[model samples]
Target: MYIKRSIFSDSFIRLLAVFLGGAIGSLARAAIVIPLAINPLISVFLCNITGSVLYIFAARICGKNLKLVKDFAATGFCGGLTTFSTVCKDGAVSIQDGEFLLSFAIFALNLLFCVASIHIIDSLADKFGKASK
Candidate 1:
């Protein structure tokens, strides 16, 4: 006897959620980064900051109830939107170009801002949760 399983399995659905979210996130990143007539590093910084904020909001709102939303928004979307590799590459290139200070600033500012945004969003979510309760 042969048993057939449906194509739309649980894993497949999750994969699809991530894929769709990633595509949307990537497009959103491009939309923000492409039009800016500024330094590439600055554009990338904006993307990372925005992604961090969105990731926090998604995590807070989705929590444990919305597994797919968390996976899609936080994991897939934010992962696609933020570019750690780009930051590293840019910093490396700056160092190679004898712009040591610029390289240092790039790494420092991104780390500071992203972490701060996460913390701020988490705090706000906590307050909002308490108030709504």
Candidate 2:
């Protein structure tokens, strides 16, 4: 039997990657929101969409060998950049305010776009061998 060890297998390195990536992602989100001063709904929409696309591409590119890319980009960066809680909150508030249409729109948009982006990116990656196994 043979064992393989990668730098990313170290718990410390993984933790560091996640921490640094999360910090940067969060800062990036703040930078966009602050400078744009967009409405919460719009901001959340943009963030989730962008994060979804980025996550899909990064995950594919990272593949199996590049655990660092998976940790930093997909897990930490995308996790920090996209706010599911915020989207849920906004939806709930909209519903409470009798804005059912807006709430539905947000919910649908988030789901559909995220799912579609993942599928599209994955297909493209497979076709182009973004991260060949």
Candidate 3:
């Protein structure tokens, strides 16, 4: 029987994707964070947004059949690699630190750039897909 991915009803394979994805992403987040005492929230902003875009890009580029790559890299690696929780925390901190303007700008930047990046990738994939056929 085939099992579709859902928050609850996902089978072992899908669950594996979620679990491994979260783990790897989390580790990568730490790796990006540990090197500097600089504002990590900005770093998180960049990471999550970029990761989100790539997630969409991967989905588009791989089409539907690239399950293994999506599961391991996009879902696991990217999920863990991005840190929404940290983003929120940093946003709050930035606001409290009298950088509300900067914080708001960062939020907008992430949302805008992430959406654009995904579509850009999708467009590239579409072009390549047609050319190959």
Candidate 4:
């Protein structure tokens, strides 16, 4: 029998970093978002956008895997904090249980909403930055 290791865990240290980083990210998310029950769609929208920006910065800072900080920060923290797997699982279940159209619609809705939120946020921020300068 063979056991497959996590992508980050091809080696022991990498695995440890991923676990620790993910724990930190998950904990931070719980701390920040648990206080209020916001709309699920809004929460997902914001989180996905936030996670994407963080990922861009993290990979840049990581620089050829030499910086563990980026990997841990993005993969562990942002990845853990985001709800992508939940979306995938829900979508899959919806489709498998014979609601293929509904599942597809939900998936499309998520993608559309998330992308729109990102655009809105960036556009506003850019405007704000210009105004401040």
TM-score winner: 1
- Ranking of models by TM-score: 1, 2, 3, 4
TM-score of 2: 0.84
As for candidate 4, its clashing pairs are none
Highest lDDT model number: 1
What RMSD does model 4 have?
7.8
| Model 4 lDDT per residue over 1-133, tens place | 1355554355677677788888977776665566648855455555666776676556655668666676588788888777777678767887799998877876787788656765666676667869999
Rank by lDDT, highest first. 1, 2, 3, 4
lDDT of 3 by residue, 38-71 (tens): 7776677768876888788767756678886788
Candidate 1 lDDT over residue span 1-133, tens digit each: 1223454576788999999889998999898888989888999999999999999989888989999999899999998999899999999999999999999999999999999999988988888889999
Comparing 2 and 4 on TM-score, the stronger one: 2
Error of 1 at 22 (Å): 1.1
Q: Give TM per candidate.
A: 0.89, 0.84, 0.75, 0.58
The alpha-carbon deviation from the true structure for residue 14 of candidate 2, after best TM-score superposition, in angstroms, is 1.0
Model 1 regions lying over 4 Å from their true place: 1-8
Better of 1 and 4 by lDDT: 1
For model 3 the local lDDT of residue 16 reads: 79
Question: Candidate 4 versus the native: TM-score?
Answer: 0.58
- The lDDT values for all models are 0.92, 0.86, 0.76, 0.70
Candidate 1 residue pairs that clash: none
**Least well predicted 10-residue stretch by lDDT in candidate 1:** 1-10
lDDT of 1 at 123: 89
